[model samples]
Target: MSLVRVAVIGIGNMGAAHARTLVAGEVPGAELVAVCDVRQEMESWVSSNLPASVTYWQDAEQMMSSGTIDAVIIATPHYDHPEKAIQAFRDGLHVMIEKPAGVYTKQVRKMNEAAAASGKVFSMMYNQRTNPLYIKLRDLIASGELGEIRRTNWIITNWYRSQSYYDSGGWRATWAGEGGGVLINQDPHQLDLWQWTIGMMPVRMRAFCSFGKYRNIEVEDDVTAYVEYENGATGVFVTTTGEAPGTNRFEVNGDRGKIVIEDGQLTFWRLREPEPEFNQRFTGGFGQPECWKCEVPISGVETGHPGLIRNWIDAILNGTPLIAPGEEGIHGLTLSNAMLLSTWTDNWVDLPIDEDLFYEHLQQRIASSNTKKDKAGSSSQPADLSQTFK
Candidate 1:
């Protein structure tokens, strides 16, 4: 296909922004053929904003079957991501799904299988992968400049959401609607980046999650998770959507050096020798390895949503490699699921968790969920998503 005709499903906050980006010709090889949303307001918005050539459909199935699009961008709620992607793949369309994959692995695994079977370009909206700072960090670790990773810590608490934000949509922070809270919603990018840069998934996870600690929602708003890797490396992930003037510091210590990313800066402490080699050769008992602190220089601005979408379109049209393949979304989701499962079971959940048990617990939460009633009373409005990208 010379040009990949695209349709965006679920014209909510993120979806509407995506539609606008495509309509503005932000992605060179992509065309906004159609947009879909069940909300009545979106049809009016389309009439006011989009060109006549860009069609709007209230039903997604009709738009997909109308043969107007070769690809679909699934930006619906958390639960609909995998389901819609699966359907799109079945209909022989490329798919770019939003984060967290699904609330649980069982369903997402099926979606991944469908994508593989369809042999279509499947990608995820992991825009953080496009950040030059993170790209450099991943390169540093992969090149062995940082040696063997010893520890990892990320304190990302800046995802502050007001009660009005939650009240904007019934599915904003509910078990039955959006699945979980901060972990599923705000921490997907960090969780994806954490494992992506470190190049490993924790074999065991012990987490403590506080449900509705600072919010009126049923899902968790605060969490602290500890994990251990197969190589004996440990990691601590702490996050909350409550604190103001919040922190976004990610630190990783390795045998040869340490790297920290905070306040849009990347700092690296270079060791003269690897710690293992230094310890073996040192005679002085009260000494540490010589270290030089350097500010790592990074070029290129973060492309964010547009970059990922462009990459997806390029992959579809030019057979280029995807920056964030949809299948790998399972890794970060596994982390989130392990954390929630650990809290739910009050125990350390191992990697390759018991999906059946996790599903059971999640189903119990959904059975008693209060948000289903409030879904009808939804008063969702357009949100300024620019601030939420970080």
Candidate 2:
């Protein structure tokens, strides 16, 4: 294919944004041939917003079999992500799924397996990976310039949401619908980056998750999780939609030095000598390894969602490598699931989590969930996506 023909499977906030980007010719090598949404209200949205040449479908299966597109961008609900992607892979179409992969790992595992068997390009919309700041951090750690990672801590509570935000989407913030809370929704990017930058996953996690703490919802609105990695590294991930004037700070401390990312700037406190060596050789009492505060320069605009979409399209058309492989998406979800599982079991949860146990717990929640589907409306608020990316 000279140009990858792409169809968006959900016309929700994020999906609509993707469609608009494709229609505006932003992603050079891709074409938005069709947009699909189950909501009847979206028919008018398609007519008023998108080009007349672009087709609209209420059914995704029909769109997949119609052969009008070579790939699909699945932006449906969390539960629908894996199911739709698996079907798309079977139909021999490349797939791009939105974040968090899926609500649970068991279903997502099957989706990954199907993707592997189909030999189709599968990518995740981990737009944050395209940010230059995160890219530099990952490089610094991978290149061993920072030495072995010793600790990771991220306090990303700036994803504050109003009660109306939860009330806007019926499927949101409910066990039977969206499955989880801030961890699954607003914190996926950070959760993904926490491990991606350090190139490691925690061996175990113990989390405290507050359900309906801030919002009038059935799911968790606050959380504080502590984790330990296999290499003796420790981490703390704290997030909530409850606090106002919140903070977004990420710190990674290694043997050589430490790096901090906050206020849209990256700063590194470089040690003159390795801490271990400095500690061993220092004779003076209360001495430190002389540190120099350096501002790590980060240049280039973040490509965000469009950039990831472009990467997926390029990989499909020209055999280019994907920036955010769909398979690695499980790593972030694993962390989130472990956090929930830890809270559910009231104990520490190990890595490579018990998928069956998690599924069983999730089913119990779903069965007991009093969450009403379509509680408000299917459409999301008019998103000022610019405010959301940081």
Candidate 3:
């Protein structure tokens, strides 16, 4: 197909943003044929905001079977993502799902299996992967310029949200609705980037999660997770939606060099010799590897969501590779699930987590979840998406 006809499911914040991008014709060779959402009220919004030729459907199945689109962007809730993407793949359509894949790995695994069997292009909306800074960082580590990794640290606490934000949506922060708070919602990109850049998943993780720590919600709002990689390298991940004037600092220390990314800048420290080799050969008791601090040059536009959409379209139309494959999403979800599971069980959780145990525990939390009632005429302020790109 020369042009990809696309439909967007879920007219919520992120979904609506995708629709707008498509309607604006920002993605080359992509046509916005239809938009779907379970909410009937969304029809009017879609009609008014989108082009006149775009169709609106209250049922996703109807739109999927309409034969008007070659692909569908599933931007629905965390739980609905797998089911909808699976259906799209079954229907022989390319699928691009929003982040977090799903709340549990069991279902996401099934979705990935379906995508594999269908032989369709499957992608995830990990827009942060398109950032030049992260791309450079990943390249550096993968190239072994940093030698053997010794430590990794990320203090990403800038995802501040208010009580009203939670109160705006009935399903905002509940275990049954949104699964988890910052980890599942705001920090999925970071979590994905964390493992993606390192090119390794932790073998085990121990986390302390604070539920309802900063808001009147039921899911975790703050977390501190300690992880150990297969090669005996250790790392710490800390995130929270409770801190303002927050920090977003990521550091990777290795035997030969170190890389730090913060405030949209990447700084690299290259050592003249490997730390291990220096330690063994140096005669002085207190000597360190000679280092040269260099400001890494990152030259590329920050594409964010629109860039991902374009890439997904190109992947389907021209056999281009996807930046974030649908199957790779499981790694990040595994880490998030492991963290929550560790907090719930008060122990360290192993990688490739026990899917059955995690699902059972998640089901229990959903069964006992207490959803908050939305106030009359109260809604979450339109997210200032400008600040969310990083």
Candidate 4:
């Protein structure tokens, strides 16, 4: 495979950015053969910005069949992800789906099934996994240096959304357009981080979520969750869009002191080399615990999604291993679904969320939502929406 023919669906901010990267030749062995979106105007934009040979369409099906495209990048709204990816797979095209795999688990699982049946490369855009720091954290945790991890907390409050940010797209905050708030748009990193770092799934979950607390949105603007893993390791997650000058900190504690990643820095507190028999001989209250910051050797490439994107392209063209396989895409989404279910049920929901029930509940939410400007021909008078909460 000399080059992978690519079609980018959805020409929104991220989609357009991806198109630019391909057009600029950031992805070698990758060519922007076509671009698609429901909006007809997007075709013209791609025509002007992308390669002259690249075709543009308002229909994804036509683009897939007509262009002889070998791969697709689905950047559509969250709810539309599964259907588009499934179609691409059926057409025998490899896929690189944008974050969260799917807003829901059943959809992501369907994609995995499609990929298996088609025997094509399937990858998710969990580019954060390529980050050097996260890669290092994963290695450290797996090394058991953290020793029987006891507690973990990640208060990702740095995701601050403004009125203009919400107003930028009608699909931005509504239930029908997107599935959820901070969990969907802002916390893909944290959600992926949760699974990657803990290396396990929750046995139970309870979450309290708020809608329109700081701003007027149909879905949650804030959420605090409690999670219990099967091994009895507990985690508390807090995220909100209302805070200014917020924090991004992940703390993991175990029998072996702790490791903290805060504000672009990583720190580890190593408990004194090993418990001495003499310490026990000294009696209970006579001695105190002591520790030092361990100088652990750093590992992994200093990189982010660009590195992941490069890998995705290479894996399809050159048969390299994917950093984020399509099979694992469902975990983060399942975690998100369980959190949403916990909030909805007001109980500690168990692992493996009932998909049929989740989709049904989600359907009802989509029906009741007031976000009028869905990409699928829904209209929103921005001025009218501007005063919707005012």
Candidate 5:
């Protein structure tokens, strides 16, 4: 286990990028031994882009059983993530799965169970956790600097995708293919970070989701969800893949202070006296707690995908703790699925969502979903995904 041999399954846009990073020796103690994809066309592409020593396989089982890799990076579709990771774990291989875990919690729970039994290193591609700003925000909250959280709001609408983007892949926005729209594909990082920094999951959620509002797809393109925590704290999450010049502002207000993160800058308003304390003792109705607005200084770059992969490799080689465990991925997916379920049922969904009901509703959507037919001379060309990482 000195040099962990790795194989990447699914050589799509993101998978190919992970393969390239491994081939370029970007992760120390990680060796790219093989790559797997069902499409035979990718064989030549891997041969041209990666090293000659890198082997290619069209079958995942063959690649896993070839004894060439000690680990596998599952970068497949939303549905295949759980199945592939389970297979890799059963085969005694470490796994680093791409985000959202899976479409639902029922399946992701099984994958986590298998990983727990296999005693293998399991990590998720929650690269946003590596961002220094978020890291600092998490620290501030955990340290109780922002006393008890009152409310949290995040307006993340920067995930703009055109109709052509939806037409690029057959599974782009379909219920049967990619599961859900922006929530599953584009906003998993933010969704994960939302709960991660806040350090709590909502006890109940009510959401309004607009399906195909901006695109000709079957899933939601716009969504607004209201959540309530056990401590009586509330939150509003608003997102859409439609608006241009979109906003990505996150604000959290607490009894002692308030923190706002936007445009790579973090601003904190410190109250000289706690809001609750000031409110209780103040005699004047017009008086409020005095505050000092300060810009929090953050160092280092926002290490994206590469940093996450490096940490995963280090977790395997040096027993370093994972930034995002594969098991915790279910929390974010729970929130996403709950939102969709709330819209589907037209009711507030309770926490630890009813997996059976959610799965049934999802199945109904898949049953009635219209498959997108590919038009002639409109083949999907891989876009430069580097621009999409935030």
Candidate 6:
């Protein structure tokens, strides 16, 4: 099989992982053509560990213009996704960007428009859908066995990040740098899952968020949001980076029964048969509701981030459908912006994220945000498997 030439922008922790996967050939039909980063030493740092065949550049525009790449992965800071990936589009390369599509909805829209104009496969790094347990749960819901999803709630306080974690990089936990906190970073997975599972976006939302309670960042470190869907289904999303050993639980209650996913496992107590309301011809006060008798075990192909990279390469090379399209990324970003705007203004923020008003507010926050970089320029990388993967 022919390999797809791949180039990557941003040589931070996650970007390095993407490049290594391509170099090791774990992502079938993918080759690491080049790497780029803003840091002057980042190119050499990546070159030292990669095969000598792979090129390196300090500027993405220069690297893409060098006519050596087929597709590009944009993994830079929050605001850079639009400009860099749009440039990639202009260079006739397919693009895969990280989450939020930059901190503002307008930027995401602009990128989406560019993707439309280029007619190339445009994707986002929403890797959570690849997780097997969540996919299985989505299946159960789609089967109509869940029976009218009434309420969905998630308390994702398990993402307890220390001050050091926030201070580890310059483009982290600041409005100017990263935009928002838990909701923007740690909770994007949950937010994506929320919309993906429900198959709908909220009509309106009201939220309350805490700014810099536990970390030394300039944006929110905690958030509580209430959302209402078009079908009248309601949801509560509570997330925080401040709480230690908190809770990571998703409770989905329907007219039929309830399903819970916690600690990386999915458990559903399916009713033995149908509930009493289905055969409600007679009085229903004489007996209790029937219940199911088995625990569903979830299994998925453990590809981590490489799965997404492989999918994008296949889409660009062989005309496979994209797993996470650029348009879907905007929904979560709009929801997030609405939540933040609601909290900041002390009132409910309506749906579709009043783009102009929200942008104005975000500009103020970003302008005033002080990005305090950590002395430690990097975080520990995940164990490399190039020896085995190769």
> lDDT of each model, Cα atoms only?
0.88, 0.87, 0.87, 0.78, 0.87, 0.78
Compute the lDDT for candidate 5.
0.87
Task: Tell me how candidate 1 scores on lDDT.
Answer: 0.88
lDDT of 3 by residue, 1-390 (tens): 899999988766677788889988899999999988776676788777889889988778877877888999987777888889988987889999988898899999999999999999999999999999999999999999999898999999999998977886677899877788899988888899999998999999999999998899999999999999999999999999999989999999999899999998999999999988888899987778899998677889989999989998999989898998999899899989999999999999999899999999988888888863222111121323342321
The candidate with the higher TM-score, 2 or 4, is: 2
Per-residue alpha-carbon lDDT of model 1 for 100-206, expressed as tens digits? 78889988999999999999999999999999999999999999999999999999999998888787667668898878899998999999999999899999999
Report the lDDT of model 1 for residue 382.
53
Query: Please, what is the TM-score per model?
Result: 0.95, 0.95, 0.95, 0.91, 0.95, 0.91
Q: Choose 5 or 6, whichever is better by lDDT.
A: 5
149-230: candidate 2 lDDT, tens digit per residue: 9999999999889998787656678898788899988888999999899999999999999999998998999999999999
Task: Kindly list the per-residue Cα lDDT of model 5 for residues 1-390, writing each as its tens digit.
Answer: 789999988776678788889888899999999988776677788788889999988888877877779999887777888888998998899999888799999999999999999999999999999999999999999999999999999999988888988876676788877788999989999999999998999999999999999888999999999999999999999999999989999999999999999998899999998998999899996888999997777877877888888998999999999998888999999999999999999999999999999999988888887753222111122524553331
The residue-by-residue lDDT of candidate 6 on 154-203, one tens digit each, is: 99898888887766566677877677888887777788888887677888
- RMSD of every candidate to native, in Å, equals 2.3, 2.4, 3.1, 4.0, 3.0, 4.0
For model 4, how does the per-residue alpha-carbon lDDT over 1-390 read when each residue is reduced to its tens digit?
Answer: 798988888776667767778888888888888877776666566667777898878778877767478998887777667788888888889888777677788878888898899889988888778767777777788988777777889899988888787876777788877788888878886888877875777888898888788897888889899988877889999999999989899998877678888877788897764334335656666575578887666667655655666788899878899988877878888877888888787777888888887888888888888764355311121212224320
Show where candidate 3 strays beyond 4 Å. Answer: 372-390
Enumerate residue pairs that collide in model 4.
Answer: none
